[model samples]
Target: MPYAATTGRSIAAVTLIAAAVLPLTGCHHGGGSRPGAPTRPSAAPRPPAPGDRTACTPEMLRFHARGVRHPAHRMLLTVTNYSDRPCDFAAQPYPLLRLGPGQRAVTPAIGPSDPGTVITLAPDATAYAAVTTAADGASGRGERISQFGVALAPHTAPGQVGLDSGPPVRVNPRTARVTYWQSRREAALKW
Candidate 1:
């Protein structure tokens, strides 16, 4: 019975020491708080600025010029069907070419004079439109302007007007247009 009591006391003493040391081990010993302790106030993330084109893509490439010469300026715009299912595309309003990033170039409030231009493509298929300019340039001859961007069809695969894979074409600012001698079909899918 004495040996059993001694063994019990030893075990109890060891358990008490272990319990006390375990808690102390967790206590921080440094003069300053632990390293990498998250004390810095979490930085408030800044919101994106208005009219920022951060989400722009190659398929949205588009530009239009019209004068008394041609009532409807011919536009070769690329369109993509992103979904697995086929999609039928109708004419979208001629996107106005803005000079700078902040300006609102295209207004959605204006209705199209004619909207029967529908083009259908199979799933994952990309198509191009030879669209006429919606804006009437009857007042004066607007010089040919070069504008390009990604296609903006909702839920559709992104498409581009110019080929981004090839060497960037240098455009003459004075000419106000970039000439691509390639075929229309070739130009549409290049980007």
Candidate 2:
């Protein structure tokens, strides 16, 4: 091919690429309004920003504990969002569990940690955690626990709640387990 033809093809290619990319450059498609402009609502709801995720404070949640009759050794603890705004919470794998009010040793998370897993609860929404107090025939220390505390964060005190019904819940903190905060009771129980 002649040099001129090669040069012409090169120019055409560059022009085509420039045309395609020009539209993408300096184009702001985010769901944000320009200053002093009439804001247009986004068609789809925007996900909460990272900064918007305030940890669910103790005051914002109400804890409840109840024995699972079907699952003899397991109990369900739920955290209901009593606040007016949405907030985020997660069991850093699992929350710090105290078998009893006087128990000083934080029951370590029993299973693998699911890092970065967080639950965002809206006002009035609830999250559940399935706690396995004592595994039958399992080794380690087993103690009868009628009351327990769930410290959502390291700095905060655990929110204690009594078993609403049934016998005293028995637990071996070393072998005990609590699932990460789940959106539903079924999910928590599955863990």
Candidate 3:
């Protein structure tokens, strides 16, 4: 009975030592534990913010110009939406004529102050505008410029001038994807 008791105590001691040592064997501090080991939780992955959307493109542009009997020029511009979604847009006037060495281009001295106009375009829809330029009574005849320059209001940003025209310019809204078509021949403007 005495020998059996001693054997039992020895077994218990071995079991206790093993319990303590086994955990330590597998326990690595992940890195060298000199001082102040970093205990910060691993950074959680985050999703992109709402402002990370792609920009819109101008699908179509057209211009028409006409010379009137009273020394005035009239221009009509059409912009088409080629994207799957609707787009809001505005216009910026760009002079089409380059003044020659002796020639001068006349623009209205007191014209409309507003340069931007907002329009919505449904997928495949077109927006049009009419611009009139009055001549300043001067001397010789000058060459008439035909082309009118303008750009898409949104260009590719979100804001007051952003393109929110329809359903937020989504991708492939229905059957056809958004696309654009411009006039093949350039229209002339008489001076």
Candidate 4:
């Protein structure tokens, strides 16, 4: 009986070892299958299912503003998921604006809409928001905008990103509007 118990434990330990090793070996890591002795290909690792993924951290998300040439004056605010997992943005994220040398957070004239359709950003995937500096060609003649302030969470002060490093972008602030984040660039650019 004593021998049987020890054997059982040994078998379990070996099983755990094999479980770890087989995947590595099957991928041609274990001496190349004894010089091509009928080697079998290993399956590629599967990504975690949608439900198994976690929310994106501030570090995992990247923000960029691409200028759009139009009379209305617009920019595409892009948020990219750089992490290995998928993430969801349940509601529209508000952007904090900083302008001139003061670098104060000025709320844009536009407001974000409530939760729209759920958007899931896969790793390296991008979502877009439309930023309009001027609603019309003749409007906002006196408003000046320097840089947008990044905020990781709602109502949080200054995000990890540095938007003020670049040259200031002057625009008519009165008509400026930012649409809610959208899965498609077209949707964000609609307004």
- The lDDT leader among the candidates is 2
- For candidate 2, the lDDT comes to 0.75
TM-score of each: 0.28, 0.64, 0.32, 0.56
The TM-score leader among the candidates is: 2
lDDT of 1 by residue, 89-145 (tens): 333322222222332332222233223344444545555433332334331333333
Estimate, for each residue in 1-191, the C-alpha lDDT of model 3 and write its tens digit. 69999999999999999987665554474443324545656699555454333223434333233333332333333555666665454232221221222322322212232233334456677644333432343222343333322333323321112221222211111111111222211221221
RMSD of each: 13.2, 14.2, 15.2, 11.7
Looking at model 4, residue 169 earns an lDDT score of 49
lDDT of 2 by residue, 1-191 (tens): 99999999999999999987665552466434345766666699677776766678888988888878657577888888998889887435366788764556776554543434678889999988888877767634577778888887886777778888878777776667777778878877765
Which lDDT values do the candidates have, in the order given? 0.37, 0.75, 0.36, 0.62
Residue-level error in angstroms, candidate 1, position 39: 46
- The TM-score between candidate 3 and the true structure equals 0.32
Model 3: how large is the Cα RMSD against the reference? 15.2
Could you tell which candidate, 1 or 4, scores higher by TM-score? Answer: 4
Candidate 1 residues lying further than 4 Å off, grouped into runs, are 1-72, 80-103, 107-120, 124-143, 150-160, 163-191
Poorest 10 consecutive residues of model 2 by lDDT? Answer: 26-35
Residue 145 accuracy (lDDT) in model 2: 76
